[model samples]
Target: MSRRTAVIALTALAPVSWGSTYAVTTEFLPPDRPLFTGLMRALPAGLALLAITRTLPRGAWWWKSAALGALNIGAFFPLLFLAAYRLPGGVAAVVGSVGPLFVVALAALLLRERPTARALLAAIAAAFGVSLVVLKAGAALDLVGVLAGLASAVSMSAGTVLTKRWGRPEGVGPLVLTGWQLSAGGLLIAPVALLVEGAPPALDGRAIAGYAYLALANTAVAYWLWFRGIERLTATSVTLLGPLSPISAAVIGWAALGQALGPVQLAGMAIAFGATLAGQLPSRGTFSPAERNGQELSVDPRIPAVRR
Candidate 1:
């Protein structure tokens, strides 16, 4: 497969990995102190990655990885768990869907990419669709949940952009970058985990399974594939896949969590999904640095690296 296609294919994994967190939290994890759970999810998974790689970045990457880790994994993970704790499953999922929109704005500003009107419309539509799916009349929303979800979106969005702008440096594998961030984020949260929640208690069988999936699959494997894609694709185009997260979340909710969606919710999802696709079309606006800066569509980052 082409690099760009590989990027799309790989990026698609992130949301699916993320989607499983909710089900795992509800079904397996201990039912207390979400921050504690969040910190563990980050620390152990990150440390596990570090153990495997057994390598670290040199020079500027040392700090770059730390910064990226704090923004992407550290802050985002805890906020995510807290939001899930505070809000309804659907509500959290809906708010999380806003990631793509934040990515759009960040891309336009930071990456200097010109967004097609369609992509903008798609981002808006997707946000609206997420609301329809999750929100209902008279639902009481928690301020903390709202802030947490939005914060997760922004932190992740910025990480996505930065990843594109300064992808994995030469000879530095994506796995290393993933490990660095995971470790950094984990260490950052260690104090909080100790102070507020303390170390993880014993795990039940189900919790063990959940931890395995989260640490190995979601953190290690998913991130490996993601940075592999990031190395190959532009951040903006790659982020277009952000909507897949909510779509996968909804599916997991339906299948795993026994959550149900009616016709309106389905329609909203369709419109949201369609709009995202339309925005990425070359006809709307090819996501390239030059195209974003009003220059020209010379290279499409989503193309496979080998092909490029």
Candidate 2:
């Protein structure tokens, strides 16, 4: 595969692994401890990465890492859990699907990446398709849940855009950057998890295994790939891949959990997948440093330009 294609594939794995979280949580984890679950997913993974990398954020990155941690992990986890608890799963999934739209708008303002009409349409179609895949008719919406879901999407979107805007410090790879954010985010979540959930639940072998998988394969490695992709790809392109999370969830539900997929769900999957591919195609506004500052410079001629 070409370099861009390869990067995209690796990045896609993050969400695909994330899609398995629901099944794992329901089957193996302790009941009704979303905060603790989120904590386990984040803290151990972060600390492990920090131990492995042994690189700490310096100067401005100390706070930068903290800010990113809050947006991407700390705030994101609680808001996401709140929405999932309060809203129907379908409603929550549909709200989260709007993340691409949020990323598109933020990329325009923050990263100076222009938003295309095609990008907007693809975002809308992705949300519609995810709704079809996950949404149930007559599902009720809780306003707080809806707002929390929206906020979570915005938080992650902003995080993605900022990551793209402030490329990692020279000589600092994504692993170190990932370590910083995860540790910061995990630290932020610690007290909240304690306050809300009271204490960590005791874990049996199954739950321990589940948390291990989530911390390692799901959060640490997946986020490493995600941040690495943000370094290489446009923020909009990265966020557009999010539809795969729900689609993967639906597929796993069918295959592993014995949930049925009807014609409408199948159709929705096709549409969403098509939109994801469309989002990857070269468009008018690829990432350009000049676009941000109205400078006359262009991206390096040596680096192959990623299409919008």
Candidate 3:
């Protein structure tokens, strides 16, 4: 297949894997204490990568990496859990759907990507759709959850732009960046996990397996793929795969968690997802799919190629 298609396919895996997080956390991993889960997911993954890279941030890179780690992993994660706990699955999904929309605003400020009218319109519609799907009459919206989702969006968005701007230093690969952020975030959260939660909740075998999957497969490998894809493509284009997270989460909830989606919820998902696709589509006279994916990477439509 073409390189663009391959990039798309590989990028898609990141979110599809992430989609399982909520289900896995609720069903398998320890419950209630959100910070602990976030801590465990990030720490080990970070340490493993650090060992492989043996790379440390020299000079200002130290603070930069730490800020990224905290913003994108440490803070974003627990907030995600809190939102998930407080909001209904679909509602939360729809709420988080605004993430890509938020990226548009951030990108305009950070990446200098000019927002087209179509993108803006679609984004606004997605926002309204989220309001419809999540905000019920007489049911006051959860301010904390809303803030959490918005904060996660901002953190992740900034990370996306900043990662591109910083790029990887010479000899540093995406894996190292992934590892550093994960490790840093993990280290930052460890003490809090100790003082606040103390120990992990009673976890079953399934929980252990789920945690392993989250750390190794979802957090580490998935992020590696994500950075690689982003490197090969534009930030907006690469991150467009984000909608897949909620989509996958919705599917997992339906299939595994047995969480049902109403017609309105489904419509919201459609609009939100549709907006993401529309926003990411490249204009004519850009890199082709094959050109983007080097020979080593086979292009697969099943993978979300974030090709520019």
Q: What overall lDDT goes with each candidate model?
A: 0.72, 0.88, 0.72
Index of the highest-TM-score prediction: 2
Q: Tell me the tens digit of each residue's lDDT in model 3 across 1-308.
A: 66666777888799889988878877877667778888878998999888888888887779888988887787777666667777765555566666666666776676566666876666676665555544555644588877776677777877776665556555567788889889888888888778877877887788789888889998999988887776656566666677777667777888887777789868877876776677557653235445533422212222343332
Q: What is the lDDT of residue 266 in candidate 2?
A: 100
> Given candidate 3, what's the lDDT at residue 161?
66
| lDDT of candidate 1 over 179-249, digit per residue (tens) | 88888888887777778777768888988887777778877787777766655555655666666667777
- Candidate 2 has an lDDT of 0.88
Stretches of candidate 3 above 4 Å error? 85-91, 125-139, 284-308
Where does candidate 1 have its weakest 10-residue lDDT segment? 299-308
Using alpha carbons, what is the TM-score of model 3? 0.83
Q: What is the Cα-based TM-score of model 2?
A: 0.93
Angstrom error of the Cα, residue 161, model 3: value is: 1.4
Clash totals for all candidate models: 9, 0, 15
RMSD of 3: 5.4
lDDT of 3 at 304: 44
* Worst 10-residue lDDT window, candidate 2: 293-302
Candidate 3 has its poorest 10 consecutive residues by lDDT at: 295-304
